[model samples]
Target: MSESSRWTMPDMAGILSNKIPQDELKPGDHIYSWRNAYLYAHHGIYIGDGMVIHFTRAAGQEIGTGTVLDRFIFSSSPSHPSGSPCPRCGDQSRTEGVISSCLECFLCGGELYLFKYGVSPGVFIAKTRGGTCTIAPSDPPEHVLHRAKFLLQNGFGVYNIFKNNCEDFAIYCKTGLLVFTNVSVGRSGQATSFLAATTAIVSSPLRFLTTGVSGLAAVGFGVYCVSRYVSDIGVRRDVMKIPVERLILCPGPLESEATTITDTSKEKGL
Candidate 1:
């Protein structure tokens, strides 16, 4: 989220409406197919019907939408008139042209990423998914931890909700960079509030996007194209499905299981 980045809100919205046909795609959006499914423009293209084609880096599989973004956030260098530090990682890198948000950076640890909408710049709330333990890195004696709350993507649309309350903090010790990632919700009213917000987002989309018109139109045209870089590339592929005659799968079953003699010597008449 750089001021000069080309991939701004309005720009991405227009591209989405065009490629997927706004009406069909819908507002809240239900793109992901499943655990391993890659529905969004990043990995593949959603062509009219209930099908998508993805172009991937995997050799043979490089033909269509690639890996599933199981906790992946897309990243791209902002390509606006000027450049600034990334709001997400604060990386002071300069990008040219239209560096969209479709590409991802592993630096964020693949835990969170933007889908259709853009993540607002400011204090972010990052919640821990079920069964996932949160931890902060620390040196020997010192435990310097930075806490970022988690927000649930509920029906509220995308407003970046997460009550600001420092339930976690980091302090340095003689040992090392002592860190605290996930502090327990031990009857702390503030921590409970954040946890509730996180759940809301996971369950409700109407709520997350309820903020409406987050003011992303400021970024000009160049900033816009960058968001769809991955999608545009995904759409370029000729991943159209072939007819039944072209299928490589065999419909018939094996006549019977191949039987192997108990002793190879018996079969060979040794």
Candidate 2:
């Protein structure tokens, strides 16, 4: 086949699959996958051993009620058969049982997994650079991972998409600060801004009465929209500036490199 023909061959990789080496991903490394063309998309933190802790909604779950769960980047085969056919994949066989499980996970708004065993999302993983949102962690990766696991164990169920989404969870795990840089985007941002402004106006009517209700509402909404737009753009630009050296975590030759490096650094007295 000609080089041109080879280039035309389909890249059948899953949507979450990438060429990132596994070793560089320390626990508490922020990982994200594109939910759409843009947005920080879905985010989670690596907790070693091909597992990640993230806030996710299962199917039929309401927002703000999403659970924080530990999920493997790859799914394990169901220990036993449910015997119930998955509506999405239409398979009831034992060998393909994990497919139904993964389908349910995805349908329920859980994290997408493209396991090392080669389960595809029926789509290629969109390209992404693995990077830290905050530079130079104040705490070590082990401590950060411990914090994440602590929260997971101690009911870290409070989830606000704009203020306390997955990104917020991951960042908080890495750094003690609870923040999501992209919190100023989309409906979540708009709603939050509007709420704060509106609450201020409502709480202190006389102070804001210089502008009538109509004018106040208009001004408040306008300010929020502009602020959200500016903040979102700024945060996105900053996030992109952070260098992403490793792939999200491909679980290959470098599988234990991050831990090894951390240990070596300790031994070196760095």
Q: Candidate 1, residue 227: CA error in Å?
A: 19
Model 2, residue pairs in steric clash: 14-124, 14-125, 15-124, 15-125, 20-247, 23-254, 58-108, 59-108
lDDT of 1: 0.23
**lDDT string, candidate 2, 61-90, tens digits:** 323433442231222222213445555434
Supply the TM-score for candidate 1: 0.16
Top lDDT model = 2
What is the lDDT, from 0 to 100, of the residue 197 in candidate 1? 38
Model 2 bad stretches (over 4 Å): 1-19, 37-40, 60-132, 135-138, 179-270
Model 1 ranges with Cα > 4 A deviation = 1-30, 33-42, 57-114, 122-270
Using alpha carbons, what is the TM-score of model 2? 0.37
Which tens-of-lDDT digit does each residue in 7-117 have in candidate 1?
556554533332333345421221221121221222222222332222112112211223454125222222122244444434423321111122122111122211232
TM-score for each candidate, following the candidate numbering: 0.16, 0.37
Tell how far residue 75 is off in model 2, in angstroms: 17
